[model samples]
Target: MSVTVERAVCATPSTQRSLLPVVGSGTQVPLVDGTSRVYANLDYAASAPALDAVAARVTEVLPLYASVHRGAGYLSQVSTALYEASRQTIARFVGARPEDVAIITRNTTDSLNLLARIVPTGPDGSPGRVLVLDLEHHANLLPWVQGSGHRTTILPIGPTVAATLQSLAAELSAWQYTLVAVTGASNVTGEGLPVADVVALAHTAGARVVVDGAQLVPHRGFSLTATDADYVAFSGHKTYAPFGAGALVGRRDWLDDGTPYLAGGGAVRDVRTDRTLWQPAPARHEAGSPNVIGAIALAEACAVLAALPDGALAAHELALRTRLVAGLEGIAGVEVLRIWPDSTEPVGVVTFTVEGHDPGLVAAYLAAEHGIGVRDGRFCAHPLLVRLGAPGGAIRASVGVGTPGEAVDRLLIALADYLTTGPLARYVVEDGCWVVADDTRPLIPVHGLDGLAATAAACGPTVEAASGSCRPRRAAHTAA
Candidate 1:
């Protein structure tokens, strides 16, 4: 991976403050004189910082990084053993049997796409009728919808289980579907789903089920065995192992019957000049050089998570989520966009909009002014965001395993600042959108990543104080 994507794997503010080695030491310095900008990284739903344990393990194994499967050297054999062992770790982490296949891929999107490619086609040679909810991330929705030439039936879900089940049952009874794909949690709202019911209903229609756990796996605990999903997929980046890795854990039979997701290399058991024999399920989907480092990091992350007591993590996350939502709700001009009725149990994420400002502008201002990195836009779940009346997107503030109460407070303060002064209008005239101090820039010596450095550089001249005259100068260029 390039430095840009690799940089995303670096430590979060919480981690930086803790035992983990902060990636951008110079960047961590605050822009303001007295204030060390405590980073409120409310984008865990997109990606999470690696746990200290995961990082330590990765460090321990870095020197051991070598080609897996069939390598002549001692390190290669060790690496191969570690690689296969990591799969078992993931299987056990998700409560899967030893024989269950766990194929590592680029991310949750890649995992779902792999599953979509490998699922058996129906008697008609298509994917057959497919069932999915409107609540799905595009990763979960599109793969099944487009990959299959089959008819698709969408299930509608809202805040309540009663309403969701009614609509879901109605649709399932109507279609000759072969598969049902549901997100175990909504990335936008952080809402946990009633996946067990979904699985039960889908099976009645003779359809296998796939759970998109990209969002669910990080914040909430899950059991693949308990859910009994035919397949469970998640991104490792979201699981605090942001090394461009993810997994799709599921049964063997369906995958074994279909064509592999990719061709060549490790996917083949043996290849003749004219004819090639494919490997078994997991190996079949993993072609070319596997992401050895990524897989190691992810396995370490899962192990760390598994070691934690069950309710401790969930309780901690829920407490943060509650704090975030309550804090956001108290702010004027802030509309807490929920999954509706507001009673739904969600993870440590809350997405909403400001009455007058654009979600993108709010997110940008938060990052630029507060050193708070939150996400804005559809978050790749455009359909759901659109339905929620955020046609563009909603500002997303997600808490992670390392997130703390103080960071949430900082985010609230930033939001309050925006509500009063309005979003930084992007274009300031003489000293427009001034960055009095932006430590995330290379010139400043603190900000490390090119994306962050570029962002910091783009922000203009810094003035300790601006008079009304300077403010008026900024206002002149404002469009009607």
Candidate 2:
């Protein structure tokens, strides 16, 4: 049952390649002044850096890119064919039916907006009821809250599975909601919802469910067909394909009959001065020329995830997360943000607040002083933050395919340092955060790019060597 950890360090973007070439130099950002630093990318929840393979694939296909759909030229035909094929590939990867409409939008936000627009109008022409959880990102929450007069029911995800299920059951039993929009995983704490159970409950109440997979898909592969949800949405940027593209994958009927969310040339099957007949589900929602290049890049990213050796990638991320949680434990004044410790269903992202420290200050110190890149804010999960009694927010450290063990060590070391020496004197922002890292007052790197690269390459392999097994393999890759 033990998983072998496969090294995917070679998968980093070339710009991130270290001097020795094996380990990655901190971030792609060039530190103007020489300082000792390792690019610790702990922002995978917000957006994962593009996989080298995904980027290379995009580059290879860019020159061949042309307008898609019904163009007479060979390039157009090729592009159209590739675009449609990408849809099928994505659908299959996500366990969706081949006929399921896979429409690309700007991001998760855009996909939810489109889904909101297409919801079947409720009885008496009133907007239908929408059920959402307190843990949902604003991207999932705002769309329904702002949608056409939809009566909203904010469902609470209790601290325990039994409590959560019972609460959701009671809510579903009472209301005939049209749609239940839930996050597959919490971006802040990396807690995965019991989506299959939620979907069953919603369906029993005669409501459809929309899963926000932006956080879920990046850390773990997902299958909509097996998920029991009616629709799934996620962003490519979070999935290591930062082309500003996202997908809304679901059944065809709602999209086919619903009014087109965006109206344009490709989306129209027939047009007249008086009236126009809209195209099918995907095209009806996709109005513009479309980010063909972005979609291809995202598809390529998905393919890269698909091709990764068994459970190697997920195990790697999970190992890094375990290290993070363990390292932070017993540290005085550190409070880890968590949802239901009894549940093992989570990705690597972990959030915590250091006592007597501003999250912004801590995050800034990590980035400027240590050359670490982490996110610190409400993380767009304001409601969840409020519920957790965190008025400001928490510092978040997330790992992914490219993150190395040393980077995590550096983060823990930095926090340990902060805990030892009260918050550094220079960390306080006088005017505002914008004033601290302004172009005028740049934080110098201790190690120049060359020195940093050399250190990273030398230290990288050593750090990974300590990742003593206990990793989980991909579901299919395991022999069991």
Candidate 3:
């Protein structure tokens, strides 16, 4: 059941400051007209900028880093201890149950893929179907779709979010299944789900629940125990720790019962040419050298977020979202996207579309003319995007702890200007994105990156290029 989206009214602003410092919050980016502005980074939904606390933690551990569990040196001992402590820290941050173990992985996608590998099979040697909603990120949706012989049944969205929860309850009551997966919040609309209620329904129907928390952890805090979710996966990058570290925290039985995620060093209790005995997880799955620094940095972010005064984070984000959504809705040609009319508390995400303008053009115009950063396109939730009738694309502006009211005001002003008078610079479709024609923006030169283009040509086409899908090419030149 799908309901019409609702709009929020504008709120009066108070004397509010940024909640915390984030790296690159004040960095100036050159505009196309040889002017510049401090880049208003409103792309937190994609990847949040690093928190100063996380950066400090990384610096503290950089000198102490050594081989994890592969060395007996003093540095190794400290590194190993840090790695283990980090695992525990992340687990506790999510309110992990006593029996739950946090298995560190590369990111949310990697963590979900790992959990997919361990889904239990019946005595008949067939994995049962796992149920999911239609609004999941590809990270949660695709793993189950292309799972190891496990079928997937997606519940249809209801008119209202409340009605959707009812639909989920009915679906679970009627079907016999292995597990149920849902997103803690929708990445496209930023609506938080009734996770605890969903967990109760799934559990009552003899199923477990796993939440994709990549988008939720950065804004709203949740607990595996409070929500009664069996498992949860989240990305550190989204949580203000832009490191390649994430985790799957959940029941340990399935982990130990499954095959090792990777076969290599540190996975074995005993190894011989003829036979080997594997250790229990997470060591069993986390083979090869672990990302010690990344894990530690992620832990630091969790700690900092956990320490925020009660209601401080929520109040900060609510003010930002209010200004964003109300401003977009108030605009003459803009329409903010939402799934449920009853979605009471959404995060600091507002996706909108302007009439008669492509999302690519709007995004390009924002950056080139206003020095603002926003995400455009399907946002990796292709099915959801199609359902929302934004198959072409849409523009998303997400805020974080460091985002100030002035930044929100800037975005609104720039957008209003573009719609009212049209863009100052002409935009043309170029390499899958909109680009200003004959742009004169100078590239920031980095040391030792002169051969970057040569090295790429020497190697081969990037995975995107090879796959016939490439990112928005950053060239200043217009496409052929």
- The candidate scoring highest on lDDT is 3
* 2 or 3, greater by lDDT: 3
Query: For model 2, what is the error of residue 347's alpha carbon versus the real structure, in angstroms, after optimal superposition?
Result: 0.6
- Over 29-77, each residue of candidate 2 has an lDDT whose tens digit, in order, gives 4232434445777778877778777778787888779999768898998
- Clash pairs, candidate 1, are 26-446, 27-446, 27-447, 42-398, 428-432, 440-447
Candidate 1 local lDDT, 139-226, one digit each (tens):
9888877845556777667557667777877887877678888887888888755778888988888888888888888767677788
Question: Which scores greater on TM-score, model 2 or model 3?
Answer: 3
Residue 176 error, candidate 2, Å: 0.9
Candidate 1, residue 8: the lDDT equals 17
TM-score winner = 3
Off by over 4 Å in 3: 1-15, 448-472, 475-480
TM-scores for all candidates: the values are 0.84, 0.84, 0.91
Query: Can you write out model 3's per-residue Cα lDDT over 1-480, one digit (the tens) per residue?
Result: 121223332345435578989998879888977888899899898899999999998998899999988789999999999999999999999999999988999999999899888888765777776998888888888899894778789887887888998998898888777889999888888896788988988999989888999988778887998988999999999999988999999988988878788898888889989998998988888988999988998999999999999988889999988878777877766888888888877888888888777888988999999999988888888877788888877899998898988888788878877766678887766556677765556544666644544444443433333422222355432211
lDDT of 3 at 361: 90
For residue 277, give model 1's deviation from the true position in Å.
1.2
Stretches of model 1 off by over 4 angstroms after superposition? 1-36, 124-126, 421-480
Q: Model 1 residue 479 lDDT?
A: 16
